[model samples]
Target: MKTNQFLFGLKNLDRGQTMKVAIFANDDMTSNIIFAQLFNMSDIQITGLYIAASPRKGTSSIIGGAISLLRRMAFGYWLFLVFTNGAFKVYEFLTLVFRCSPQTGTFYSLRRAAQLRGVRYRKVADFSSPEIAAELQNSNVDLLIIRVGDILQPKILDIPHYGTWCVHSSLLPSFKGIAGEFHALRTKRAPIGSTVFEVTPSLDEGTPLGQVAIQRDETGSVFQHMVNNNIAAGKLLASMVLQAFQCSAPSFELYTPQSQLKSSYHSWPKPDELKVLHRQRKALITPGEAMRLMLAAFRWG
Candidate 1:
């Protein structure tokens, strides 16, 4: 039955009327924001959402759990999460109390937004599962948009008509993997930005679609800059998707190749690196300056 459905979907590809898009993401705030933004677009139809389920803590052995916790703490991840998420939560709460515009970036708020729009959503334990590829095939998805989730295999990557794409939170190939904004902040770098690119079996080596670089505000925390980069990525993805629909064919050839010599991949910071990050926090720009930089980045598009 699934095979027949998949074939039927393929048959309709020649119509090229409206693009069908599917989202692969987690339940984090960034994923929620990307999903909400893509869901509201008129040029593309969001077929379904494939959300990566969090691993069950109870299933892990005591030693494994301890190690995981220790690793996170050693990297100052707990402190980072509290520092970043706390501010957003406070803003959300204040908006509610003041009867102002509700914050839509929260996980629950965006999930509810998706529900209100009558979009189909699902949770999957693995993004590269054959079941997921089958479902996306059956739905006739022309494009796949990945937010904050695991690396996808080629089987899933090749399922969509236009192929898969993702938003990397830094200007690649400079800062390729994980916690890009934090690295930029600690190093006092300029031209902090985001990249929207095609997804490949390789990591962040995919062809670049569009990029937006924001000037670094000297007073902004690493967390605030991270948020701004993500928001900019969401907008850039939307623009790229719209442009894809307007073209005769989705043009993968237009993207520039990433230079490995100039690129660097990063893992999560170590304990000593966290200490450096803490010390460097004093150099971040004020909130007002961060806002100005964010606005400037948006204007670049």
Candidate 2:
């Protein structure tokens, strides 16, 4: 059933007539690369890019030598984004060259919708944002695709023409929540995948757009899951999102009603719960950070 839904989405793509779309994803690196790939595959142009972790004014004070080092690292990353981002935007521009159903405009104010190609960034929280709506009201957005990391409100969900969607990092209805890797480790599961679907008011419980299973392990770390899931699912979602922008989203495989009976969103395991956790020596910590994170976690015998 799952495979059939995916094939159906592809068939819809093989027949899609228009392709104007936008993307949202939390992992900056994955969003960047996936957009690059989408540029290569379709005539769809990303209107603007918004991250889940929307950047607000904040200070990171790493005094002394660490300041210069951090700045250099940031500068290098920014440079990389510039070159790559420039290329992806070029794809957007070229793709939209012969088309105009998706209105295109550039401005700096509350009277225009924020754009992926635009300098300003927004998140699901921005739907309540008067400034964003004011600026974006006149500009038409056909579809909005989310990648990961941000939870959205219904206000944002109501903005886009076809509504909002995202690609999650786990197989839905099975392992859902804050950290699925640790969840997987505790459950001793071997594989996982990304589920692209509509965003509802529940936790990872939305009807799926699509999903692709992935491989994982007992000795794995968080970053490993992050990179793997995005890479595997990123390209497919990009392609499908473009298709969805052009028409009705094809329904994919859904969780069984029995599986849907699973209840209670679980929190990340606490220090006191280690007695029930699977033990592994894989270093998920640096001596200093581990000590700091667990400072209040240990007690004297």
Candidate 3:
């Protein structure tokens, strides 16, 4: 949708209607950026947070999560993930020990971000727990914003009066599942995009509350593009939440259900797909970019 169309439906909130919001997310660099945007909001109260240990279900422990990954993909790719995650975890540890603020565009864990915001958070194995549902009800949560891999159960979904919404990294009715941005990159989608949608039982097939797309940078690496896309998604989510809180609904003009469109759902990128990216001369992550990111995550002081 165009920028004007997105803004056309926004209405200012009355003084007494502050939304009590909760967040469900994975504790990663991208989530940290997203959480920062929410924490900065002055109007709504963030009632609670659920930071999943892993995006996957049934395997929240280090050992169980690793085993789950191996079951889904090749061992080689799992090793690649281990190394990549290890590096980020080390940076998170450093930030904690040193007590430093993350530099702009740098990585930080969601836990650190929560601490900085002074918001209490809970680490959960998955989102299906009755206990979590009870907590949301007890907190009088008005809305639930989710950016996790676990599919929520109806009990959890029913806790929030306004229902759960998700921040997705691709234009809905196009790339609808995991790594949508990656799929867009490999498929050469001209302008990559992000969507904020109402989460239903169907994966990514909810009503799109807001969306924005950008022209892909031809010169950037795949990792760079993905990171930038996620950052955009984070900002987009914050804006949508504010709009929803103010008006009690996203502008009716913006409500397009995914079922009405030719939406495609994607799973994890296969090994051949990764090879195809390389064949197209696209580097997933340049070593220089990785090193620069690591250095920026640390406090020089």
Candidate 4:
């Protein structure tokens, strides 16, 4: 559905009826952007900020960490290597030379931003912890916004009165797992976008509240495309929350059910699969054609 139609027929929140909102995400640029956008919304009362483990430290074991690093290198650097014939090494060297670690800077900036806003900031080792649940309950949060992290437990999901919502980086039901944007790019699929949905026990299986197709930019890198998708997702999430608050129902019920037949799950690609994906992305339709296909697939409600 188009975002406008999805948000139609809902009133804005009544004055003094702010929705208490807590956000969960890692300290990254995407998270920072999401937080900043939500914080600016007048209807949302920012409650707590839960920072998950950094992607650099996502795994507990060395082997797992190595695997994670390889995945990152494959997704981030491999594409460049394919086109530049490994000359991207000089670009990487120059980046290191200039101390241009954008992710690191974004992490610290997020922390500082939270401090300035006086929001309760917690670095959580486990999202499903009883401690976190208790904290949310005590704070009386009306909504929980998950921008990033692992699947949450039912206890965590049930804390918020309005239930938890997540901004997933893929069109609902389809591409419902890790590296969704990469998977979409690899498949050369159109209507590649983001979904804002109610968080359920199942991963990305909740009813979608809003969705927006991302405009593809062929000139950009994979990382840039992912960031663009995330930003659009975050904005749609904020819009959903605002519209829900305007609803007259005691519990927010503004949602569109996803199709079971159309939905599919994805996982991290294997090394061979990654090579195939790289080849597919390199050989796929141009950005203009991709955008046209995406628009054609976008069915307005």
The TM-scores, one per candidate, come to 0.73, 0.56, 0.85, 0.69
- In candidate 2, what are the lDDT values of residues 1-301, reduced to their tens digit? 3432332333334354454455655423345443444544445645555544332213222122223333433343333333333333443344345332222221011112233334344543343356544434444555666665445556666666655676665666566664444454455443466667677766577776676766765555443554466566766676566445444445444434434333334444444333334255432323543233233112100
Model 4 lDDT tens row, 59-122: 6442344456565455534433232212222333433455443122112234554555677888
Give each prediction's root-mean-square deviation over alpha carbons: 7.9, 12.8, 4.1, 9.3
Q: What is the Å distance of residue 122 in model 4 from its true position?
A: 0.9
User: Mind sharing the TM-score for model 2?
Assistant: 0.56
Worst lDDT 10-window in candidate 4: 292-301
Positional deviation of residue 262's Cα in model 4 after best superposition, in angstroms: 3.9
Q: List the global CA lDDT of all models.
A: 0.61, 0.47, 0.70, 0.60
TM-score, structure 4 vs. true: 0.69
- Per-structure clash totals for the candidates: 7, 12, 0, 0
Please report how far candidate 1 places residue 79 from its true position, in Å.
Answer: 2.7
CA displacement after TM-score superposition, residue 67 of candidate 2 (Å): 17
Q: What root-mean-square deviation over C-alphas does model 3 reach? A: 4.1
TM-score of 3: 0.85
**lDDT of residue 300 for candidate 2:** 9
- The candidate that wins on lDDT is 3
User: Which residue segments of model 3 deviate by more than 4 Å?
Assistant: 1-14, 74-84, 102-104, 248-262
